[model samples]
Target: MILQALVDYYQRLLERRTEGLAPFGYSPEKISYEILLSADGGVVQVNDIRDNTGKKPQPRLMNVPQPEKRTVGIKSNFLWDKTSYVLGISATSKRADKEHAAFKSLHQEHLAGTQDAGLKALLAFLEAWTPARFAAPHFSEDMLDANLVFRLDGERTYLHERPAAQALRAQLLASQAEGQPPLAICLVTGEPLPAARLHPAIKGVSGAQSSGASIVSFNQESFASYGKSQGDNAPVSERAAFAYTAVLNHLLRRGEHNRQRLQIGDTSIVFWAEAADAQEAERAELLLADLLDDRPTDEQEAARIRSELEKVQKGRPLADIDPRLQEDTRMYVLGLAPNAARIAIRFWEVGTLGLFARRLAEHAADFHLDPRPWKTAPSAYRVVLATAPQYKDSASMDDAASQLVGELVRAVLTGRPYPRSLLANALMRMRSDGHVSGLRVAICKGILARERRLGINSDKEEIPVSLDKASTHPGYRLGRLFAVLEAVQRLALGKQINATIRDRYYGAASATPALVFPVLLRNAQNHLARLRKDKPAAAAGLEMDIREIVGGLADNFPRSLRIEDQGRFAIGYYHQQQSRFRQEDGADSGNTESTEDHIEETQA
Candidate 1:
């Protein structure tokens, strides 16, 4: 399915006449130098074509004849290769002499009897070039091992781009095909064609080999079966192999700010939309990127995404939001991770654009809070970051985060209950750190809410998005009472103290209220007495709110709270604090909505 989908997309690009895409029988490669040759066979210059916009010199990618996949033997590319093959010199190669010979030999045979001026010039240059040319300072040391292409001294286009060279490419392919036996039925295209012995290299996956790595290969003896070897084990056609790799590498292009690609933890992902209209396909691609990543946005883009999300929340179909949108458009996401000598398929998903739009909207709703914690939608990366240690803020982590990110994205896209570990991890972070941000509380609520909707915990009451004053749940009331006690300490002490009861006892109070609350209450009374003398009205308000919360606890806190209730406890505490902050001057305002003013003043 993966390979077939890629082949189909490659055909789509060709049909659209997409620029910068490599044609069949060729692949896009990073070319760092162009050897300008005179008509007779002498070096004019080794021009550096690398882009210097970034911190380093980055190679420019170009379409060239597909290079040979060499291991230990000396094989040559059609018209371009690294210095070791093209110039017989290298930074590290023991067989530079043999490699240079292979390059010259291949060109000598292929360019024989050529009438094109450009082809003759390239062949003459190869005939006269040698590794010893480096001794006379013919080119810069930086160009020693860099991949190089050829062009006539006065021409702007490379030799491979000349009309005669292209014609020769077609003729050579025909000759090779007529004499070869049918290898097998292509697994990707289902056509009887030549089988690829070694698949093309896939680049741009982070942490993979710099030269590139394979996705389909039988490298070990144990990997083969039924007397088949290498690529015969899977039988992907050479054409299909080239097409898929070309499209994938195009999607994975770096330094172009490719919208179709995003990195989540250690998983490198690429996504695209298949639509009849190219513009419509691009619209869907950009929208999905906004959904998963925190891409830079201006006022207009942010407002547009919000408007679209509002329609989805109101149960409007995608076509209704944008008449040109094809709700049935197919969307594909592929994630890759690095293995030893090959790439691993971390995850692959195919669905309709409408389905994913609805699911992502549902994802936002599940995690929503009354006093929303974020200006933009909370990214999956932020939700997962609540679990990681505090210092690592790169939105990436070790291998464990990679696994969790895959599971998290799958749940959001499929409308399933979030993984149980997600809730546990957030709760554990709150317990240990004692700094419960609105983001962490929101994630806990989302996990529990999804479980209830999916009937995993159907017996439990529906968790409200805000404070539920009438509820009699023990954990809820205890959480509220803890907030009140902490508030009283802040009132009595103001900014004179370095720590409060919250910093000391939040973990114990949430987990085992029975053991922690009685001690907290006794100390709260002394603080209340002091406040009652200095500010009687404030003390009365705290006393009234405290009585209301304690009355529901049956005058006795539970010995221990369940894990589900612990999540509710965090939500309850967050809600009460937010509500108190919503009031004018800490006095009751009869509103649940709060702003950042109170949060900045007290939470810090």
Candidate 2:
């Protein structure tokens, strides 16, 4: 009964699909099978086909008559779909990590068989299976988020059959099953051999006068020398040999039984245990047709389906828009090497893609920042600016200029500097409303090389006004302006300030000439904080420090400045620091020292 049930089930599955069975061949009306023997070489027993009236016999026949006379044992094997089975492993975000945590834990569990067997088998297969890698190894959650993985053996045996075999089997089973003469049935048991399209044979007959070649076949290796002679290669010949042998073995075994004729038209199709000849050739010369259990060959449709499937399984880059940018503006920000990895961090702290686009849109007028050019490359956006052209000459254009200021603030906070080109444009713009202050001039000259790079022509056109205008410009505040200018100057001057000014302001007792001053002004601010909090910090001398400040001035003297010019600059910086300290301390010196007295002594 079980044998008949299995046959019925197989017939139903074959009939359910018609993909590769249609074009090539004739159909078989009846299938006859020889007994399948067990491992012990004895016949394996199974139930027989249902009798008429659709009722199974009460005492199932354990041994249906062996069709070919010689008693044979039963062999049984099960078939399954490739798509129905799955490997139950998943990857989750909470897993420790790739190194000592996640994969290690999983591998250990897999080795122990504690992990699900299906999933483990699938993972092992994946580690060895080269094809379809692009579709596997994606992120998933445990128990909740399940993804399909292919396993070798677990619960059910999944048969990887050729499309033609799968299709032909389905078509024959589709027609109503009647236990008539044309459709004979038999029962057998024992697992089927492992699936393979080809195998080698030990022997075959060779022929001479028959127009057909009667060649005695031998094991695959025997033909190697014959194949490699002054003819084709051994490997190719061996493959052909194996395939022919396998086909012959199947045909001879299945054709052991015979006798069935079902007439559809002038052509009389006979369904029996096996096929005697290739149907196409036999049809041309004979009266009756014999069906064989040979491979049904259809290449194109299978190839097409596989091609489409592969295309659907590939990975693609992610793209989406955020709420911040409503207008159409694209910006590209490039990071420097290691910084590129922290793109997400920058996004969260600053803004999303939309936020960048919106900022560019908002400042379109002043900076004339257009974002269209940076849509790709550098992989992430960093500091890019753009603006609309219409507001190029507006007085409030400086408002768009605030973006530059914000960038500067970020620079100070991060202790990184912007590129020279960006710094130059910012300074030239800032100088527009006022005389460039001493600090601003020094910084702009030092880092940007603005005067050197932009030249006099561009400077006059780019800088809006002099330092006087800058001090009073609405966008400029005193303290921020001073800090920004000092920072730029320190950066421009090879990160060094005059030793005397460094000691006086930053309290560096061992100030050396040419020492790169990383954060002079910042250090000064810290010193001021110490003073304010009444911290026990070493006090900075005002006069001797003033002399060293002059000495340091000589060290930073630009080539363009004459001796007289240097004298004036030294006096200016000294007085500037003094005035700054006085304000910080709120100490009033009613009578200020004469500038002439200080100058005369310095000159002497």
Question: What 10-residue stretch in candidate 1 is worst by lDDT?
Answer: 595-604
Best candidate (score: lDDT): 1
Best by TM-score: 1
| Candidate 1 lDDT score relative to the true structure | 0.81
Task: Tell me how far the alpha carbon of residue 529 in candidate 1 is from the true structure, in angstroms, after superposition.
Answer: 1.6
Which residue runs of candidate 2 sit more than 4 Å off their true CA positions? Answer: 1-150, 153-358, 368-604
Candidate 1 regions off by >4 Å?
135-138, 170-182, 297-300, 317-321, 391-400, 584-604
Q: lDDT for model 2, on a 0 to 1 scale?
A: 0.26
| Candidate 2: worst-modelled 10 consecutive residues by lDDT | 372-381
CA-lDDT, candidates in order: 0.81, 0.26
lDDT string, candidate 1, 138-243, tens digits: 5877887789999898889999998889888877767766665566899998888888878899888888998789899898989999988898889998789989
